[model samples]
Target: MTISTNSLMSLREYFSNQQILICFNGPISTNLIGEIGSALKEHIESNHAPELEVMDVFSVYIEMSQNIRNYATSHGFSDSESSATVVIAAAEAGHYAVCAGNLVEMGDGQALLERIHELAACDKAQLKLLYKQQLRQPHTQTPGQGAGLGLIEIARRSSQPMEASLDPLEPGRAFFSLRAII
Candidate 1:
């Protein structure tokens, strides 16, 4: 299928208008993530962002991307199913927004959405206290037991509350998207 020039131009304009710095959509892997992370770091640094801000944005990007990758791996999803869309952009109030999305089972997506909501409701201090408490807890090697610490860490690093959504898709599955602002 050929992409028309007009479509490409429109897409570029949309990205520019949205303040997107970097975007990716495909099967996610550790190496791919590392490469994209390097680019993200350079982009933020080039923008003259503070060291702390750059680190925080990069951390959130890593966490969100890894979460998508891990979920797809644990669920034994196909490459198509495992494909993820991640975007990093400048956000309101000079913040950086890191968003990642992938397919998930219906139940799993709902549960994750609920968890994100719970985290979103917490104040910064509350998030920090929760992070500390989670740190003190025992580690479990159970598969798909996620979101334990990484999600909390993202919330702690974010300047604004994190957000998530579940959109219905194929039968028994949905698209799960998460956003964090740093």
Candidate 2:
């Protein structure tokens, strides 16, 4: 099934039984991702979840947030001045999901969606090879953004393949929603 592109709140009702490990959005940067990761790590520790489980959530969140940072900077998306909104939340059933939405040029959406579809169809071994190959390839200079290996990385890290959707906002811009679950 395709991943839900809707807001997380619409995905399900919050549970009293489950703790919100972390949630934040606005201006993605390496520092912001690190800070959120640190906070979630603390939350997980206090909640007494297993160390491995906490580490998994922390790692995945960092990667997804970093992707948002890259995409926003490449697209020049600024809220106040230089702020992007990205959310990472830990849920029940040992699930941790990261969602990042941003404004992207229409041209960029097609390549990203194709990559998502390609990643979703690949097996683990193929994904590993593709990741390595991408790292080795010459970088192409796109007009508005860097080439997207981040989405592939997210798909590789996820227990399930990454999910993404595009919503048209205007003539030349669209809202891109990406989610990875670990």
Highest TM-score, which number? 1
Model 2 alpha-carbon drift over 4 Å, by segment: 1-20, 48-52, 80-83, 139-148
* TM match of model 1 to true structure: 0.97
lDDT of 2 by residue, 1-182 (tens): 65475654554445323444455646666876787778878977887888876777677677666666766676667753235456666644677777667667777877787778888999889988888998898787764354356556677778877888988877987777777777
Off by over 4 Å in 1: none
For every model shown, what is its TM-score relative to the native structure? 0.97, 0.74
> In model 1, how large is the Cα lDDT of residue 53?
94
lDDT of 1 by residue, 86-109 (tens): 999999999988999999999999
lDDT against the true structure, each candidate: 0.92, 0.70
Please list the Cα RMSD from the true structure of every candidate, rounded to 1 decimal place. 1.0, 6.6
Model 1, residue 154: displacement in angstroms? Answer: 1.0
